[model samples]
Target: MTETLSIGERVAWYRRRRGVPQEVLAGLVGRTADWLSKVENGRIELDRLSVIKSLADALDVQLGDLLAEPSLLDWTPDTLGGTVPKLREALMDYQQMSPLLASDSTSRPPDLEILRTEVGSTWSAYQDARYARATRLTPGILAVAQHAVRAYEGEQQREAQALLAMAYQGAAMVLTKIGEADLAWMAADRGLAAAQESGNLVVTGSLFRSVAHCLLANGRPTAARDLVVASVGYLENDLADASPTYLSIYGTLFLVGAMAAARIEDRAMVNQFLAEAEQTAQRLGHDANHMWTAFGPTNVAIHRISTAMELGDVQIAVDQGPRVDTSTLPLERRVRHTLELARAYSAQNRTDEALALVLDAEELAPEQVRHHFISRHLVTVWVRQRHGKPSHLLVGVAQRLRVIG
Candidate 1:
């Protein structure tokens, strides 16, 4: 019944249904009645997730109840919609819950090498920004990893646990990117559990990165930052003789911490985290993708741009964003950096450059820009703020993203 209405109209319907007056609802959400009226009348776009959530809380309703569009396929691919449920089912399967109950002939002596190859291939697809493909492959890999953990014992069991951790980490990464925040957290938590069972500190640190990302996706940046800090402290003494994988994961934690701090406007922590990450990058002495982290000197520089934006230092982001060369990075990293820079350009009202960058990102990965919150929000803003007939380029992008009819 609400499918045909704009988000504002939906809000209005809920407001009326709950018998909340405009002024009373507005006050509850810390807004004026006039503002609420504008929102309800579709005179304003509710773009911020935080504000949307606040409104939901005030109305005593689930967030999805207000956002229950008939389909996300206008922006999200069918691949995502189809695969997420499969991934969830795989994660919640009985085999993942207990190894004792999973002992059957079909699970006996599974090929570890084949499982490792499948896990690695899924991560590679994720790094390349083939998100839908990666998601499609996750369920099978997760199922195999679970079976391996169930079948093996002693040292082989530990090895199987490591594989399970990596598989869960990959699933978490894809889920986070596609805005499946709750499922992402579950995947990360499961990965962390597997990593601990494997008794691999490096893998544990890497899983901390995934957990921190889930925290950030769920708007708990402070918790994310603290987790990163604690994980780094736990791993700090090992860096003296750390392998490239250890260094990469260690440095990447600081980067994630910096981003988390930036979200809360914690300038001191942000600076401290960036400095630590940069020093680690210098120690490593080059760009590297150790353990699929894509962490090193170049990545540290990219984080600086990301943190600057998060801290609302838009000019700094604008100034330094274009200087980094991301060609050596994975396609996902490269496209992500491009989107951040485009966001900065839009903030500075350099609309042409922002649109061009958005187009460039689309050319590189059509699914990414369409599904990304940044590109979708920026395009929506551009379409709304335009005075006259919008440009064909802008219209085309918006249409593909389903920001407009």
Candidate 2:
């Protein structure tokens, strides 16, 4: 007779099949490799519900699959008792739509009703955190979402698949912002896989564009460019012109292409791609907000300023930089925009204006100002040039920002 596997054994088996080395899997799930090894060997018990769920997610297995003891099925109902019903419900809900919540506009009311009923208490906890809770919940949410996608694969539920993909994408964005680049990439990969399997060309393109953006942020612009170029065929071939989602995805890809081109010092290609993005943006109807154009007009303008700065077009950067409404931009993006403006002013030999802009940005978000790549780089360059007396205003701003650090 075959030996029955415990939950730990099952988790280990699935993780191995997924080709995730213990060390890498442990790091992704925020556990020590040794501890994970002990858990797998059945020498150590995992009691924390969150940790168990995180493990299940990393292994791409259902939570029940990890917890199930096949030989224990003969035990009385009291053995598992009150938790069994909840576990069954969670499994069933995970099967239906654990990752993605149905959208009000896109989903049928009945389908939404089913999901709402099935998700139950879990949904409440998931949405409870109000402002900037990405740091706390992103990893757990991502794990849950990934597990949901794994469960629903090949089940012919297009809506469920799309929702799961969106969840993965959302989790990835949160992770990326929180400085978990590898985890962010993994989340993006899961989203891309689901998007491809669901045959949603718009989603597929958007996922790739997101992955490229992550890569670009992680300092691999070449890899980012390759991903974008690879995605173009899918975007052009499978996407319909009437689909605003598709157009928005294409426009984002072009925006990234322009940035990548600028990174590589290819001014001609950068201009060409930006022009293409502009044309695509023009074609987008009023409904483009539903697509991946979350950045929209302000974001595009910010990129224009950055690109102009990179291409030595100081006049263009200055003109467009001020046109962006700083109030509407996110704290991080606004800081970056201000830093770019500072760089533009510095390039124009207006050290006083550049320092003043930097000071303003520091006041908005001191932590953001301190860690900002462009601002730090610009200041370094300006200081090295010994551009006049070191401005007292800049010194005061730096001292205040240090308090937050």
Candidate 3:
């Protein structure tokens, strides 16, 4: 019944149902009554997931309740609302918490090779932007990874733990993409614990990226930045003979740090981090997807555009976004950067170009486009602000995104 209403309408309804005063609710989320009023009246758009989560907390409702994402026709089965519970169940399985429960005399020994291959497959699907397929694959991979970690002994056990850590890292990333930031944090924490058990510095550093991403998703950018900085410091002493794996992990940390700094509008730190990342990329000397980090000169350039966008230098992003060729990158990276460029176009009132880019991105990865908040919000604003007749292209995209019936 609530699905038909806009987010603001739902907020207003929930606020009234709870008998909460506007001022009180507003104060709870650190906003003024006037701000809340604008939100409820749909005069302001709630683009930030952090703000939406805060309102949900203040209203004593689930985040999904406030989001009220209309189920898209093509993607409903694997929607965030539909898929997160299964992943949550897998992550929360009691057997993983107590490995002894998973051990049995009749059970077959876990096949380490199969488990490793499945983990790699999961990440490959994810990098291809097949989020639903990746999401579906994660629970099984995690279950097998946990079993492998329990079944193996000595060095094999450590190897299994590293694989488990990578599986959890993949899970955390998928959760973040689906807007389950809290769950993502839990997955990252689990990954970090597994990484420590493996005693692998590279795995630990990579898992740090997952944790930082969760922090950024949860709107704790300062904490995210600090975490990345510390992680980099931990790896600082080993750079003398750093492998491509180390360079990728080290450089990607700086990229994530740049993003975190950008969120807080820390101009100096943003520049510092970006410069550090670029230097690391140059040392690597070419585009490579080492450790699935996608750390290279091209990737660094992509982050520069992203940081610029985050810092509200829309002109810089607008100027630099189009020239960068992401053709050699993973499908996920390519599509994401495309959406970022679309957002810049929309911000500059180049609606036609923005719409075209969105269309192009949707063709490349329909699931990603449907699930991304930026695309959804952009379509919503375009629909709301339009006059007598909307563009058919816009209407088609909106319908596919479930922004309108």
Candidate 4:
């Protein structure tokens, strides 16, 4: 007979499968490894539904899969749906509390558990909306995240500050994906500031990496490189600790280095950075599954494709591009992979393939203005190579995009 696993045992099993040690998993989940061990052994119980769900997500399993009885498929709708609206209202109130707290300490404060409960509910709702691509929910979620940061700052709570910074970073990443570069940059900056004020070097370094990514996506390669270089000293010191945050920052710096080298047409530098990135990733393993480093393997592979194309290594690009599983990635990242493949195909004089890939990307993100910019850049390089006649399709798309004069 198969062993019956309690929720805690399921969590432990999944954590081990993910290659995360108990201590490391505990850090990511904001608890002690001893506590997690007791919970896994069924000697302790946790009442926070949100924490349980978060743990499930980190383990790449559904909440139902992690439960002992596993019979609550329909039960969540009643338990969660009825509470969402009130939770949303409470989250908003918490957001508003930041500004109030900044100005007036005499005001009575809600319990910490209350804030966590509401934030957890709001986060679950946001995740559902995110997967559905509900654009309307983004702004509201972002507002709440901003408020959380401000409130944490007002209260001078280190853990709260780190969590709030993460919330802002997640919002900014979504905004960036949806073609709001300016707003994303603003949010990233705010998160960085909060991280610095909290005196968490790990959070600060990670936020800098996010800022560099926004700069890179906006076509500011030089600025991005400078930001990455500035992060090197901090990352070097932090990496010795075996912290997941350090691994994330170190990997991100390598990615930034690869991109910068590609921009300047330095093949050797690109290869060096990619190699370093791979080494760091191997050392870190899946055990370091902090949200800060979620981009690891996928990010490294994407940059490798881009770098290979820039260096005219067509075979390398072709071989590596198809190995990536774009379906596991977000839509924004999938669009980027398509754009890179288009460029790589064009480099090999595969004009038809190039055009097909670009068309697919355009269709996927029709309303996203930045995709057009990327398309124009790829088309310009392909045109320069004299791979094909400048057809009406190219001219029409470019004109509609207004990216090319």
Model 3: CA > 4 A from native? 1-82
Tell me each candidate's TM-score. 0.86, 0.59, 0.87, 0.57
The RMSD of every model to the true structure, in order and in angstroms, is: 3.6, 16.8, 3.5, 22.6
Write candidate 4's Cα lDDT for 1-405 as tens digits. Answer: 011334566787888888988898788778899988987775554323345655775777654445322111111233333322332343345434366544434444334454445434433433332312323333444444444445444544665566556555654554454444655576678677767766777777778877886775454566776777678766686566666667876787788777766765667777888998888877776423354354567767888887776565779989889788766554556677788887677656687798888877767764342323346545544443344667777765554444344
Give the higher-TM-score candidate: 3 or 4: 3
The lowest-lDDT stretch of 10 consecutive residues in candidate 2 is 69-78
Q: Model 1: clashing residue pairs?
A: none
Ranking the candidates on TM-score from highest down gives 3, 1, 2, 4
Q: Candidates 1 and 3: which is better by TM-score?
A: 3
List model 3 lDDT by residue over 344-376, tens digit each: 888788989999999999999888888787787
Instruction: Pick the lDDT winner.
Output: 3
TM-score of 3: 0.87
Model 2 CA deviation exceeding 4 Å by range: 1-132, 150-158, 174-180, 238-240, 285-288, 295-298, 324-335, 362-370, 379-393, 399-405
Positional deviation of residue 218's Cα in model 3 after best superposition, in angstroms = 2.0
Kindly provide the TM-score of model 1 when superposed on the true structure, using C-alpha atoms: 0.86
Model 1 misplacement above 4 A: 1-82, 106-108
Badly placed stretches (over 4 Å) of model 4 are 1-139, 142-156, 174-181, 217-219, 286-289, 325-331, 358-372, 376-405
lDDT of 2 by residue, 1-405 (tens): 112344466678888789989999999888899988987875564433345656876776654455431111112232333222232243234333433542323333234334423332232222221113323333334344444444443543565566556656665654444344555576678778877877777777778887986775454666777777778866677555446666778878988887877766678878887877777777773323444353456666778888887666789988878888856544656677888898888777798898889888777655445544445444544443454765666555544433111
Higher-ranked by lDDT: 1 or 3: 3
Per-candidate local distance difference test: 0.83, 0.59, 0.84, 0.59
